[model samples]
Target: MASGMILAGLGLATIGFGARFIIKQMPTMGQKLAEATKTFPKMDSKAFANSKYYKGGFEPKMNKREASLILGVSQTASQQKVRANYKKLMLLNHPDRGGSPYVSAKISEAKDLLDKN
Candidate 1:
């Protein structure tokens, strides 16, 4: 009888865990979770750009100056243009899309410099 009770509890626990996983994986639930958060941290754009993290063989070095050129803009590109270029480059080198984070971060840095200056 004790063994049967243990088996039943384990089965119930397994079912509960499976149900929880399915519910959490739902796209609506994920969106709701993102929106429900009131205070999420913002990405630090400047430091991200200046860091040497993004230079992973796609170029000899990654710098904001180079990024500005890649976006077909000058170092004097306006903040708005910098933002637009960053988005365009991100789409091409997004780590989640199989691109390197180091490259992405360099692109981010370049955009930040243009935005700040």
Candidate 2:
């Protein structure tokens, strides 16, 4: 009976310790969440929804990151490499050659955007 009482007391002490630790951490967790919300735009916002890079849908305006993905090159790829890759992609996806017009157009747009950067 004394052993059972001791075990119960130890369990209560452990729970109290855990509760205190969690309570102490709560403030920091809340602060980090606050900082994150301030640092990034909400995912549901129109800007985020329409983003070509983040949302994974192509847009009329090409972002550098999106352009890099479309061209299969690094974001910092040189203009010459961009052009070469563009040509290769166009050869495969150009509409006249039975490839996707949409894809071909995106490839061209990506090269142009990257060249300008």
For all candidates in order, the CA lDDT equals 0.77, 0.88
How high is each candidate's TM-score? 0.43, 0.50
Error of 1 at 82 (Å): 1.0
Candidate 1 residues lying further than 4 Å off, grouped into runs, are 1-64
The number of residue pairs in model 2 that clash at the backbone is 0
Cα lDDT tens digits for candidate 2, 8-41 = 9999999999999999999999999999989995
lDDT of 2 at 45: 67
Where in model 2 is the C-alpha error above 4 Å?
1-55
Q: How far is candidate 1 from the true structure (C-alpha RMSD, Å)?
A: 15.4
Model 2: colliding residue pairs: none
The C-alpha RMSD of each candidate to the native structure, in angstroms, is 15.4, 10.9
- What's the lDDT of the predicted structure labeled candidate 2? 0.88
Q: Please report the TM-score between candidate 2 and the true structure.
A: 0.50
